[model samples]
Target: MSQHLLHTPLYDLHVNMGAKMVPFAGYEMPVQYALGVKKEHLHCRDAAGLFDVSHMGQLRLRGENAAKMLEMLVPVDVIDLPVGKQRYAFFTNEVGGIEDDLMVTNFGDHLFIVVNAACKTEDIAHLQAHLLADVELEVIEDRALLALQGPKAVEVLATLNPQVREMVFMDAARIELLGQECYVSRSGYTGEDGFEISVPNSHAVALATALIEDDNVEWIGLGARDSLRLECGLCLYGHDLDKTTTPVEASLLWGISKVRRTGGDRAGGFIGADVILTQMETKAVDRKRVGLMGQTKAPVREGSPLFDANNHQVGIVTSGTFGPSITMPVAMAYITTSCSQLDTVLFAEVRGKRLPMTVTKMPFVAQRYFRGE
Candidate 1:
């Protein structure tokens, strides 16, 4: 490991629990614990899994003009985002490319944001440059983020705060957990019923310890995190998405708010509105993001070149892993638009051999979000 690698609040605890630490996004994070990636991946789907995600960037934006200032940067409807709700958005470049994806929560007087760890520095600078004079930006480094995910997430978290049982997916609130005032959101990246807790650094260890004490909960690592998100077809910055990939081409057109579309009020005012909205209507994009399932047990990995019937290079795999839930190799790739149809058979060259991959619908397992009845 490099001497300059950073550590999260749970670094010592992770080491104590026998985590196999690795360098990820400038942090010495755990890639897997003794449970290993395969078991941890399946455990999260059946029971609950605890994940240390404190390395991700958390920010607080304050003042009355904060929403209005943020509206100019992304092509999402932020101004009317109801208080106590969280929404997914991305920073768009002038060319309609995704700068970085993030989650924004309306906290009444202020907004809470979580961005990709690798892009936090640039995200903060971008926010500072465009925000109005009255808006205040605070890079929150004093809090530690943890994600509790799986089918039993609500059952485990309810033991800490019974109120959490009533909170639905994308709901955000301040709650007391193990005597710590924490920001709690009923959301996660694994496409499961889960909760993300942002606790003060001082209480991070205690909070994590309390959660993992449950037999249903076990520590999960980055390796399983990647596979979990991949199974859900979620985009990872710098992998499935980057500065050159537009949301439209990524099959993320649904993320663009209807109010921000071509003819709606307050439309076309964002940085890349002209190009993005045009692509939405014309569908002129030459390539698209799609899910690929391998025909055999062999795995298709990132950077593997994709091909067509005539051996013509078409696209490249961005993320691939054997999803424990499905017991098969699954991958997400960007393929030429003409060959991206569902059920379209594509070929991926791995280790000098062309393997068959079929274009498949995402979320290999159905998402199990807890929405209140």
Candidate 2:
């Protein structure tokens, strides 16, 4: 491990809990606890798992026109993000490639944004250089984030603060926990009922301890985090998404609000909007992102090449792993339009052998998000 690797606020707590730490996104993060990745993955599926996601970047954009200013950078309905609601969006480049994917929440007074950990430095610089001068882009360095996810997450969180039980998926709120004010959102990367709490760094360890003490909750790490999200069919920034992949190519067109597309009121106003909107209207891309599953037990990994029966290269795997919950090898890849269709047969070249695979619908495991009634 590098001596200069950054540590999250809960680093010491992870160490104390017997976590195996590794370098991830420049931070020395826990890859798994004593229970291991497979167990941790199953635990989160059956009960609850707590993760220290403080390494992710949290930022605040404050100003009267903050939403309007942000509209210039990404293609989402930011201005119409009702207060206390959140939206998923992409930060696109001039050529329509994804710069980074993020979550934006309208806080009534300001826009609270969360970007990927590895892209935070560049994302901050991009925002500062592009946003209007009056729209102050503040890097929130004093906060720590924790994700409590699973079928039992609501029950565990409600015990600490009953108000949280009322928040549905994508709902954001300011809540009190152990007398500390924190921003709580009923949202997470894993396709499960959960909450991502942004709390002050000073109170992070205490909050983690309070949650982990619960019988239904256990310490989860990055290894399980990857498998869980992969099973849920979520993209990892540098892998499934990158500067060369456009939202349309990545199958994230649904993220582009109808009002921001070519014909709507706020259409084509954001960076790369012209290219992205054109792609959306015409479906111009040759390749599309799709889900894959191995027909056999052998696991296919990232960077593996995909080929047709005649041995012609057709695609490349972006993210791949054995899904503990699905009990199968699941992967995400970008393939030619012809091979991207569901149930299309393909072969993954692994270690000199071509293994049979099939294009399948994502979320190999069922999603269990808790959207309120």
Candidate 3:
């Protein structure tokens, strides 16, 4: 039996543009267009690329205890997150394992959150079940999300609304685009200067069309999206993160604010605070997420066994791809802490051959996020 796949508002436009479609997160989404993945990846790095990210889930949390309630689930300093600011965080489980990684924006009256498409359902259920007392979770089902990314992103988008240029990184505003109200944020996964716009589904086509017509903008697809994010060292929800992976092991300690840790005022109050705090204090994580740079053109894919000097298996690749921007194959993996140091030598077993790989710093491509002066 075929699974019933949902279609985003821009599905027809994608087909009309000669995009190759595939099933992703229960939705029929474009994997690549006629321009191909390599071209799309280069275009985004050189100019601007428009991506249909409507498959992502958007939700609003209301009530006076909205931030307080959310603090019980994640380690971010939500209570102090100023209005109009966005923070990257993860929804952690009771044992310090990650349930889902997400973005939380304090919208003054309500909190706006964006979760991974595949984890949206469970994320909402978790919130409702745990925060039933005072917080209300309202799914924003009537909006379509679009991401405009690259070096020329700011220039192209500023032409639509000059106010967009005024906004800094991680700052959001309720702006009007092509005569429609949109919640716009200056943030993205591709490590570029970009904006993620959430517009009403009714006017999604019009907005997308307007952006596509821009000279600097090209329609991008999932293939390039994956490559772009990989080069940027961003994690894919299902592959790089799961219930068994904790933030400490994932090297995402930056997401947990100092105020939320053991010595802070509101210490260790979240679901997995105990385990997470212990790992932080003792640095006792068995495995750590590290970047693998392949010396050859062959891309080392996920699940490939990583070996040490003695050819003993130490870990496995979690996400790997040909980084078009960097023009090489790069991968992310969790390996024994002993081998997680920079410049550590390792071998990836791909096919029947062993390939030499070096542990390198992530974000193979430099990020151009527009943080204000």
User: How do the residues 77-169 of candidate 2 rate in per-residue lDDT, one tens digit apiece?
Assistant: 998899999889889999999999999998888899999999999999999997786789899999999999999999999999999988998
- Rank by lDDT (best first): 1, 2, 3
- Residue ranges of candidate 3 with Cα displaced over 4 Å: 1-3
At residue 16, give the lDDT of candidate 2.
92
Residue range with the least summed lDDT across 10 consecutive positions in model 2 = 259-268
Candidate 1 lDDT tens digits, 209-321 = 99999999999999999999999878899999999999999999888999889777788788888999999999999999999999999989999999999999999999998
Q: Rate the local accuracy (lDDT) of all candidates.
A: 0.94, 0.93, 0.92
Instruction: Please give the TM-score that candidate 2 achieves against the real structure.
Output: 0.99
Count of clashes, each model: 0, 0, 0
Q: Evaluate model 3: give its lDDT.
A: 0.92
Which pairs of residues clash in candidate 3, taking residues 3 or more apart in a chain or in different chains? none
TM-score of 3: 0.98
